[model samples]
Target: MCNFKLSSSPSSLLVSTTKNHFLISPQPSSSSSMDPQPHDDGLHRWPTPQEALEEIKAIGKISGPTAITGLLMYSRAMISMLFLGYLGELELAGGSLSIGFANITGYSVISGLAMGMEPICGQAYGSKQMRLLGLTLQRTVLLLLSTSVPISFIWLNMKRILLWFGQDQEIAAAAHTFILFSVPDLFFLSLLHPLRIYLRAQGITFPLALCSAGSLLLHVPLNFLLVGYFRLGISGVAMAMVWTNLNLCLLLCLFIYFSGVYRDSWVGPTSDCLGGWSSLLALAIPSCISVCLEWWWYELMIMLCGVLVNPRATIASMGILIQTTSLVYVFPSALSSGVSTRVGNELGAGRPARARKSMIVSLFCAAGLGVAAMLFATAMRHRWGRFFTGDEEILRLTAVALPIAGACELGNCPQTTGCGVLRGSARPRIGANINLGSFYLVGMPVAVVLGFGLQMGFAGLWLGLLAAQASCTVFMLRALTTTDWTLQAERAKQLTAATNNQSSPPYPPFDKQSKAAAAAKVASETFCSGDTARDGCSIEMEPFIIIVKN
Candidate 1:
């Protein structure tokens, strides 16, 4: 029989056995076990060095699809702009203004909602909790649907709002018509956001890129035929928008169903996965508010600018510049999505060091893309104006603004990528607050003061806006640079584990028979010397023997 001894010292205990080796770990007291244990709070918490490098590489690979999606989406937007320009100044203004409004209302809201899914789904995916992933998607879809009704109402009543802006009857009428055609598309658009988020969380991004590419192909021809040949004007543009959104939604749905992800045993709804409706609402509301506030600030700026100058040419020029800047924003926007998904996943997997490394890689990549875009914008600055209109005065004025436009790209890339990093961490409120303070509290007032009070016109207003964005970029970069990845990883792990229980075991420990069988075939053996004629006796043993003496 093995002999076991109790030691006076509580911390150290030893057991002596004749055969097998044994390990002893001191069990904590009941009170100690019940109490919280101190956790590692270092700068990074990747379990191993190899894991850190693997995460960075994985995140880097995932960004390709995101970048492609951004490019496709940008192409669609540009094509729409091109179509609007072909229709004449009044139609261009009307189309541009209406598109701007719908985008702020619909696209921005969808984008925000999509962000809500990243942290939740990314964590779930990282933890390998497939069921929780499906439930999160379902919950997001339900919440987004609920939010859509209020937005639809807002879209329907947009004309009344435009009337308050002092828009002429013609512009107001065109805006109303465009809105009517566009509002119904929100339902389809809502589905698209959640679907994109779901695929992205799984590190599957090519589907969105492919869908966007397909939609753009169909969108261009439809816009041309409806607006150019059919003379549908603003209505044609609205129709094209609807068709594109519908196509995107359908394609995404089909891909999700066919990918077999839905049918996979690891994925789908579970008892604990559904959670309370309130949990989803809690996340969604803040996310929505954050996005709405940011978009609304820009809309407010545009409306205020419209009323500040006479002949409305000033507003039109500003709209042109906004559209131009938005086109270049696609690169950073894609990079941001890539960062959020990758960072959230790594954090959820309890790899803080990897998350930090991925963030750095994303920022560097985004900055490189930003530099290339700036160069392109600068080189093509003079030629770009002719694409929008034949007006010499508009072209001349736009040319003057090119350098500043290029400068804005520098700030835009970092700010957007920063937002993505924050969103992946489920910290949209921070981004929202930063945008509000920077744009409204500082940027807007400065622009208004320069444009009207100082009588410096549109250039002054843009200059002030640029300064505000630059400030925002600085603040965001600082926040990203100084983020505590260890804390982020812990939070990510808790959230992911809560949502999906990926850490839970599917089977319990082995039974007694299995344990005995495992032990019997590998018996302990020893060689000993006792008494022999010429040499020590050779001993054969079934179990290995270990001798200890004190």
Candidate 2:
């Protein structure tokens, strides 16, 4: 009989053994997991220059492809807009209105809801809890698909809803026609959103970029065939959008199948997915609120612009500026996704210090990107509007508004990145509350005061946006700065371990073949390290399991 005792710091791994069985648990390390228990000379120090560079490299690997994917996705929307513009102002206005409605009601909801799985999947991957990752993906997809039903119904009644809101009848009818055709998009996104997060969590982003690029290559051609040659008009535009998404989904499935990325995790749908939704909902609802609040604000600003002194010029300028901010948004959005993955992965692996460092590096990177965006916006202010319109008033107003929008980007980038940090740490409720306060409570009143009360006109409305971004940035940075990484890491472990009440045991049960393989791998890695005590082991922790050597 072999008996062993284990002890370690709160952040360090522990090991115990009994009757020829070894158990390993998470512990702090100096270098990497392979060199656990090295000297801790600078345990809590800020990352060194070299370490910072390495972190930058790691973040770039994730953010680079993520940015490309984002740009490609943005281009799809742009292409659709261009097609609408070509059809005439009525078609463009109606299509744009319908798109805004869809975003607020459909796309945003699905996106935010699906994001609930990010922290879970990312942390699970880091903790080597492969089964939890797959199960979470399935559960999220089920939740999104269920969510799409009501959203589809809302889209079906788009004309009624818009008419009730006092919109022009002809525009409302056209909007309805477009949205009616877009209903299938809701279900397709229900699946695509989860799959993207599923792969993103595992740092498999290059494939996403590749798939998005492929879909985009087909997007223009499809739009041409549908909207132009086929003479389907607005309906055709909607169909092309839906088919493009469906094509992307098919491409992702093919890639996953051919690459066998699902081998380690996917186990097919089970009864487990039917019941364990509480864990997902906890994160999903707040995430939905956070995303929707931000998205709705922009749409709200567009509405507010409708009441300005010169409605045509102000509203048109607002649209162009909105597009400008959105374009600048691509980089920070990618950075946010990257940092979320980094922080979640590090914490899941029980490396609190590394997680903190990742957050720091991400913030710095966001700041730099923000500066660059600001400068570019300022320099291109005079030229950007020409690409959209030649209307002297709209162009004049756009040039005046571009600089302010640039300033907004300066704050927006960091706050956006900070939101990702919060999400990665499973604190989206905090981000939601902060957004509510900053946008509604703080920003909205100022916009009303300046734009209406003080009569600053369009610029005043933008100033309100600046105020919101500033407050959001401050609060977001405060939240990130005060995070407790160790506690977050512990929480990650618990989250991945506890799937649901009716689910299988805390740790996924392994089959005989897998058990043998895991045991062999553990033995090869740990026993050969010369780091195990005579009766104990220094093996890395699995979320929960116990194995006996043969």
Alpha-carbon lDDT, every model: 0.63, 0.77
- Tens-digit per-residue lDDT, 443-483, candidate 2: 99999999999999898988999999999898777767666
Model 1 lDDT on a 0 to 1 scale: 0.63
**TM, every model:** 0.76, 0.85
Best by TM-score: 2
Question: Candidate 1's residue-wise lDDT over 418-511, tens digit each?
Answer: 7778777755555766676677777888888887889877666777777777877876776676665655665565455444442321222455
Per candidate, the number of residue pairs that clash is 4, 4
RMSD of each: 20.2, 12.9
Q: List the residue pairs that clash in candidate 1.
A: 524-543, 524-544, 525-543, 525-544
Q: Clashes in candidate 1: how many?
A: 4
Span of ten consecutive residues with least summed lDDT in model 2: 1-10
